[model samples]
Target: MNIYFVRHGSTEGNETDQFQLPTIELSERGLKQAEVLANRFKSIPIDIIFSSPMMRASQTAQAISLVTGHAVNENPIFEEVNRPTAVRGRCKSEPEVKEIMKIVKSTFTDPDNRHSDEEDYFQIRDRAQKMLEFLSKKEERNILVVTHGEILKMVLALVIFGDKITPELFYEVKRTFVPDNTGITTIQYDLSFELHESGWYVLGWNDHAHFGEF
Candidate 1:
C-alpha cells in the first residue's frame, strides 16, 4: 500500500503568517499551486482521495479529483492542530499571539497540558495514531491524503517512531520540518513484512518538484 500525504496549498493566512481561521480558503497562487500538484498526479494512479474538511485542503483535493476523477472523502482526522480561538485570524507577530504561542510551546514539555480550547500534545498524538489505523483498514491500495502542516508532521512522526515517540521529539521534528504548500510526502507498506518488522517506510518527504521555479 502506498500512502501519499500532501500538505494543503497556501492560504491568505499562510502568506501573511497569521493564525489561520477554520474556514480559510486558498489564495490565488495557492489555486495555481494545486493545479500544478494535480498535474503531478496525472501519471500516478490514485485509488482513493482523502482530505481534511477544511476549505484549503478540500480545494487542493478537489483540484486533484478533477484530474484523477476520484471523489474526495473529507475527514476531520486530517484537520490542522486545534489552535486557541483567541489567536485565530490574528497575525503571528502580534504581542498577544507571540505570548500565546510561547505558552503553547512551553506546554509541549508536558503532553497533558492544555492552555485553553486548543488540543494538547496527547490529543494530537492519539489523532495521528488513529489516522494510521484508518489508513491501514482501507481497502484502497493507492491512497492520497490532503491535510494541513501540523497534522502532517504528527502523522509522519507517529509512522516513524510509533510508541517510542515523545512530546520533546515531536516538538523537535515540528521545529525542524516545515512542509511546503502542496508538498507531497509518501510512505509505503509492504504486506509481506511481519508486525515486528514494521512494514511502513518513508519513500519521500516534502516533494515539490512539480512546481519548477514557482
Candidate 2:
C-alpha cells in the first residue's frame, strides 16, 4: 500500500502574525498552491482522497478532486493535533508562546508526560496508526490525504521510529525535513513483513517540485 500525504495549503494564519482563528480558510496564494498541487496528482492513479475537516485542507482536497476525479472524504484521523485552549487566538510573541510550543514539541518524543490541557503524544500516534490501518485494509491501494504540517511531522515520527524517538533526534529530523505548504510525503508499506518489522519505508518527504516559478 502507498499513501501520499499532502500538507494543507497556506492559510490566512500563515500570512500574518496573528493568533490562530477557529477556522482558517486558504489565502489567495494557497488557492494557487492548491492548483499546482492538483496538477501534480492529476496523472497519478489516485483511488481515493481523504482530508482533514479543516477548511484549508478540505479546499486543497477539492482542488485535487477536481482534476483527479476522486471524491473528497473527511476523516478526523487526519485532523491537526488538538492544541490547548489557552494557546489559541494568542499573538505570536506572547510570553507563553514559547512555553506552549515547548509543550507541543515535548509531545512528539515524550508520550507519557503531557500537560493536562493538551493532547498526549500517544493519542497522535494512535490516530496515525488508525488512519494507516483503515487505508491499508481497503481494496484501493493508492491513497491521498491532506493534513496539517505539525501532525504530519508527528505521523512521520511515529511511522519511522514509533514511540521511541528521543527529543534530540526529533528536533534533528524535523529541522531537516519539515514539509512546506502542499508538500508531499510518500510512504510504501511492504506486505511481506509485519508492520513492526522493517515493512514500511518513506519513499519521499517534503516534495514540492510542483511549485515551480511561483
Candidate 3:
C-alpha cells in the first residue's frame, strides 16, 4: 500500500493562532497551497482520496479531487484531536497555550485522562491507529488522506515507530515532525517483505519540493 499523508492548508484560526475550531475551511493561501499540492500529485498513481469530516480538510480534499478526478471521502474517524468546546474559537494566552500543550502531552502518556469536553489522549491515539487499520484493510495501492496536524503526527509516529511509541518518541515527533500547508509525506508497505520481515518504508518526510518553501 502507498499512502500520501497531507496536512490541510491554513485557516482563519491558524492565521490568528487560535485553538482549533475543527470546522473552519481553508484560507485563501490554503486554497492556493492545495492547488499546488493537487498539481504535485496530478500524475501520481492514486486510487482513492480520504478526508476528515472537518471543512478544512474537505475543501483541501476537493482541491486534490479536482486534479485526480476522484471524489473526497469524509470519515469522522479522521477528525482532528478535539479540544474543549469552550476553547474551540478562543485565543489562547501563553498560560492557556501551555495548558493545551499539557493536555497534548497528557495524550502521549495517559490515554485515559480525557478532559471534560476533549477526547482522551488514548482515544486520539486509538483513533489514529484505526486510520492505519482502515488503510491496511483497503486494497488500493495508492491513497491520499487529507487531515489535521495533530492526528497526522500521531498516526505518522504510530506508523514510523509501530506500537513502541513512548513519551520521548512522541515528544520527538512533536518537536521535529513539521507538516506545513499541503506538505506531503509518502510511505509504502512492501508485500515482498514479510509483514514481520520488511515493513513500511517512508519515501518522503514533509516534502514540499513541488511548491518550494512554504
Candidate achieving the largest TM-score: 1
Per-candidate Cα lDDT values, in order, are 0.90, 0.79, 0.81
**lDDT rank order:** 1, 3, 2
Q: Enumerate residue pairs that collide in model 2.
A: none
Please write out the lDDT profile of model 2 over residues 1-214, one tens digit for every residue: 8889999888778777544553788899999999999999977779999999888899999999999888999987888877777776566678897687777676655656665456665676677677777777777789899998767886687668855765565456667767899999998777685656746668899898988938
Show how many residue pairs clash in every candidate, following the order shown.
0, 0, 1
115 Cα displacement, candidate 1 (Å): 1.6
Q: Write one digit per residue (lDDT tens) for candidate 1, span 1-214.
A: 9999999999999999998997999999999999999999999889999999999999999999999999999999999999889899999999999999888878854656756788888889999889888898899999999999998888888778878899878987899989999999998878676653557768899999997946
Per-residue error for 118 in candidate 1, Å, reads: 0.4
C-alpha TM-score for every candidate? 0.95, 0.85, 0.88
Error of 2 at 27 (Å): 0.5
Q: Which residue ranges in model 3 land beyond 4 Å of their true spot?
A: 94-108, 111-113, 194-198
Q: Model 2 — which ten-residue stretch has the worst lDDT?
A: 108-117
State the local distance difference test value for candidate 1: 0.90
Error of 1 at 187 (Å): 0.9
